[model samples]
Target: MTKIFFLGECMVELRELDDATMGQSFAGDVYNSAVYMKRCYPKLAVAMITAIGRDRLSEKMLSRFNSEDLDTQFVFQHPSKVSGMYFIETDSAGERRFTYWRNDSAAKKVVQFLNDDVVEQLTSADMLFFSGIPLAIIEQDSRVAFWQKLEHLKLAGVKLVFDPNYRAQLWANKADAIEQFNKAFQISDIALPGIEDLNVLYGISSAAEAIDFFQQYQLEELVIKDGPKSVVTLTGTDLQSHKIIPVTNVVDTTSAGDAFNGVYLGARLSGRTVSEAVQLGAKAAGTVIQHPGAIAPLAAFKQAMSEAGL
Candidate 1:
């Protein structure tokens, strides 16, 4: 079985309702991908690498992970630390704004849990998936060590995948974000970045410019997703762009990119062609945006996959 390791943080989310009630859930970039990927490839070994506190919210999160069939052996539990939390509010168009209270999240100290044994376990994975936010959480020295371990795994033939979901608020400045993203790109075998994120990070206006920018690295595959327009992809020297099927309505756009990344990579790794994978990605993303939140119901996802002929 091929093993995939996703490294990131999962935060408890409070969604305010009309009746002045709050609904609790968990969400994060790579964690969203992990859930979908594990569902797509149930027999494959999928593990999430992160830390959670010894709290009820954390326990709920672990239960969800088990239900999702995601491996949690690599998850660290800290007594004093607390799990990160965020609150979300959405308007009529289902566009969301978030307020976070997560400074002392246990996942921030994730690097301290890394050692030779942990690195060995990570290296054993066939694929490693993560996002830029993980880099923002760790200390400078720990970040360097993390990068070194990734390089080691790459040399050992592990495929590195990254979604450069750049958040300006997470970094010191634009310059720092650029520098850190550059490091991840250097070690990455597959790059999945949103068109808007590329524009913000590198001032690259179009999908063509984004692909050209990432061409500087030794990346085996690169995908730049632009909502409702087209998804531009580069595999080796062959560049192809697939037009997105127009959606009649969009209920929410919260996790469109993550859904695309998950289904796209899942299909490709399962032997689908690039064009077929992009189509699946677009279909999955379109369906997700028509719903709410990051992880849509299992039935909704299955319907999307069926409609896409997956």
Candidate 2:
């Protein structure tokens, strides 16, 4: 079995059900991808690598992981801190607005749990995936340690996938985000970057500029995504553009990019062609955007996958 580890946070989510109602759930960037990937290819060994607190909400989080079929071997528990929480407000158009209270979340100290044995386990994995959210949230010294481990894993032939899931609030300044994202791009084998996110960080407005910017990095595969537009992919010297079938009835745009990242990587790792993977990703994103949250209903996503022949 091919083992892949996803390194990030899993926060408690509170979303508005209506003016006087709310619903609670658990989700984060890499956590969403890990769950969707496992659902897409159940035989693949999928693991979640992060820390949670010993609290009621943390217990719920762990249960969610188990129910989603994500491996919990690398999920550590902290004594004092608790999991982070965020509130979401959706407009009439289903666009999401977020308010976060995650400054001292247990996952911030996740690197403290990355002792030698954990590092060794990650190195033995077939792939490791993360995003700019984790890069921005972790402390600087701990990030140094984590990057060292990522380098070691890269040297051991573990494919490193990075998604620059940028949020302006998570980072202090654009310069720091650029510096940290550069380090991530340097060590990554596959990079899934949304051009809109990069526009804020790099002043890049179009896929051409984004692709040219990535020319500096020695990436095996690079994907530049723009919502409802053609996606651009670069592998070696071959570049291809894929037009996404626009979803006219988008309910929520929260997990569109995450869905694409999950199914595309899942398909590629399962020996599908890049075109096939992109098709699956696009179909999955179309379905997810028509739903209402970051993690869509399992049956809906699987049905989309089946429709796409994923």
Candidate 3:
């Protein structure tokens, strides 16, 4: 089995259900992608490297991970801090607005638990996936330890996959986000970057411009995503364009990109060609956007994958 580790946070997610109620669940950027990928291909070893509290909410979060059948061996328990929570509001267009309360969340301390044994386990894994969220939240005091661990993974030849899921609010300034994103690209073997993230970080708008912007990196595989537009990729020096079949009714656009990242990487790791993988990823994202919330229902996702012959 090909083992992969996803390092990030999972928060208690609350979304308004009706005028008088709110629906609760567990989700975050990297965790959402990990869940979708693991569900599509259960044989892959998917471990989440994050920290949670010992409280009841944290326990429920643990149960959710268990229910997803994700490998929880790397989930650390924080001594005092509790898990984070966010409330989501969706508009008529299925666009989302978020309110977060994660300043002192347990995941911010995850770097503290990256001891020698954990490093060995990560080194042994085939790939490690993470996003800008972890890069933004890791405490300034613990960044040295975090960078050292990344260095270890690089030296051990672990395939580093990165997505710059940039949120301007999470970063103190654009320069710091740029610095971290630069380092991440330097070490990554595969990169999936959204045009929106690039627009925010580097003023990049289209996939063509994105390609020109990323030409400086030593990236082996680069996939540039433009919402509801053609997905573009650069394999070594060859660039290809894959059209995204549009979805007429958009219920929620929450995890569309994450869905693409998960299935695209999953398909590639399963020996599918880049073209096939991109089609399957488009299928995954299209199916996800037709549903509500970050995670679409399991049965629906499976049926969609089966229908697509993924």
Candidate 4:
């Protein structure tokens, strides 16, 4: 079984329901991807690495992870800090707006809890996944240490996958985001970046420019997502574009990209070709947009795959 380690935060998510009520769950970029990946590939040993607080909410989050069958052995508990939270509000068109309450989240201190055992756990993984959000949350000093550990893991043959799930509000400034993202790209074997995010973050006006920028990093594979449009990809010297399977009803676009990342990686790890993986990823995201939250039910994912003949 493939041992996959995801390093990031899992926050308390409150989404506005149709009746004006709020539905609560646990999710984050990498965390959402982790959940979907586990559901897609049950035989894989999926684990999450992050810090959680010793609070009731944290306990509930742990229970949810366990119920999802995700390994939480690398998860750290902070005695005083609590988990971060965010509120999601969707518009008439199903686009999402977020309000964050993560200034002092326990996940921000994950680096402080890292030790030799944690290092071993990370380095031993077949693949390690993280996102731009994880880089944004950790302290600057801690980020140095975190990247150093990732460098060692990469040297040990653990493939690194990164998604530049860029949120403008998370970074202090554009320059800092660029710098950190560059550092991350250098270590990533596979890069999953959204064209919209790249355009906004790096001022790249077109898909070609975005693809060219990532190509400079010499990644083994690059996947660029453009909502409702064709996805651009590069594998070695080959460059290809695949169209998205459109979703007629998009309830929430909160985790569509995360869903794509999860299913795409799962498909590839299961020995599917790049074209096959992108199709599965597109199918997964198309299904997720019809749902209301970051994580659609495992049944929903399976149903989506079946409907797509994946």
Candidate 5:
């Protein structure tokens, strides 16, 4: 079985349930992807790498992971620190906004606590995945060390998949974000970036210009997602565009992109063609947008794939 590792934080998510209540769940960019991927490909070994506290919430999170059948050997536990938390506020249109309280999260200490055993586990993975948010949360020195480890892993023939899930609030300044994202692109074998995120981060103005910007990295594969519009893909010198699966009722767009990344990568790793993978991704995203929160139930994803004949 192929071993896939996702590196990031899983935060306690709070969303308004009613006029006087909030609903709680666990979610994060890569964590959401990990869940969907595990659901999509049960035979594959899916694992998460991050630091979490021994708090009750963290315990609940681990229990959920176990129920999902995700490998938890790589999850590190901190003695005193707790996991991060985020609150969601949706507009009348069901578009989501977030407020975070994660500066002191245990996941920020991942690099500080990585050991030789952890490095070996990462190096042995068939695919190692992470997002821009993980880069933003860790300390500067740890970021350097983390990237260095990634470089070593790349040389050892481990495939690297990077999702530039850029959030301006998570970054200190645009320049630093650009620098770090560029460095990540250089080391990545595959990149999943949203055109809107790229335009906002680099002032590229147009999708063509944004594609050109990423082309400088000479990645093996690239997927540029444009919300409700077409998705563009690049393989070597070839480029193609695929339309998004139309969503009739979008309840919340919280995890649409993450769902797309998960299904697309899962399909490709399962030997599906890029076009097939993209279509599966679009279908999954369309299904996810019709639900609330950062993770739709596993059954929802399975049903989406079945309905799409994937």
Candidate 6:
């Protein structure tokens, strides 16, 4: 079985759609990926590593994780730190914008709880997944410790998948964010970056430029997403492009990229080729934008999977 470990925060999500209706859900980059990964590949062993509080909302998130049959044995529950929260507002065309309230989230301290056993768990996993936000949220020492541990895991042959989900508000300045984001890319075996993120972080003009820049790191597989345009990927010396599958009606695009990363990696882990994986990723993302929340209903996702032959 493919065992994957995802390290990041899962927060309480409040979404306001085009219809002006509001609803609450749970999401974070790695957490959303974990859910979609588990759902798409039930045989794969998936676990999330993060810190949460002992609050009611925290308990509810755990229950939701359990319902999806995700393994939480590696999760940490902090004594005092509270979970983070974010609010989403979507435009009529289904594009999303976020406002966060996560300055003091419990996940920032996750590295402090890491021990020898935790290191062992991560090193033995088939893959370790994280994003730039997770690294940016923590303290200097914690970030250092976390990167060292990840380096050790890489030496043990655990693949690293990184998403440079750059949020400018999370960092002290643009230069700091660029430095750390590049640092993460160097260690990443697979990179999933949005075109907008690259523009925000590196001032890149287009997806091709983003791919060319990251190609310097010699990533094993690179996928660059440009909303409603096309996805650019590089496998070895062969660069390919796939057009975005059209969404009939885009209701909200809150988790479009996260959902794509999840299904794409899930398919790849299940022995599909890079092209096949991205196809599934595109389909999953297209379906997600047609819904109102980060996680569309299980039935809706399954339907999309079936239609896409995922």
lDDT of 1 by residue, 1-310 (tens): 8888889899897876568788788888888888877666677788889999999999999888889899999989987888899887777776778898888899988888888888887878889898988988777778888888888889888899999998777788989888989999988999998878888877888987887788789999998888689988899888998888867777767778878888788888888899999998888888887876777889888877787786
Of the pair 4 and 5, which is ahead by lDDT?
4
lDDT per residue, candidate 6, 1-310, as tens digits? 7899888999999875447686788999899888988888899999999988888888888888888888998778989888899998877787778888877788888998888788986777999899987988987777778888889899999999999998878889999888888889999999999888888778887977887688579599888888778888888887999887678798987778898999899999899988899889888888878888788899989888988885
Best by lDDT: 3
CA shift at 112, candidate 1, in angstroms? 1.0
Q: lDDT order of candidates, best first?
A: 3, 2, 4, 5, 6, 1
lDDT of each: 0.85, 0.90, 0.91, 0.88, 0.88, 0.86
lDDT of 2 by residue, 163-254 (tens): 99888888889889999999999999999999888998889999999989999999999988988887899999989999888999878888
Per-prediction backbone clash count: 0, 0, 0, 0, 0, 0
TM-score of each: 0.96, 0.98, 0.98, 0.96, 0.97, 0.95
Q: For model 5, what is the alpha-carbon lDDT of residue 209?
A: 80
Model 4 score (lDDT): 0.88
Provide the lDDT at 258 for model 5: 93
Misplaced by over 4 Å in model 6 are 16-22
Worst 10 residues of 1 by lDDT: 35-44
Q: Say which prediction, candidate 4 or candidate 6, comes out ahead on TM-score.
A: 4
Q: Kindly report which residue stretches of model 2 are placed more than 4 angstroms away from their true locations once superposed.
A: none
| Candidate 3: regions farther than 4 A off | none
Angstrom error at residue 130, model 1: 1.0
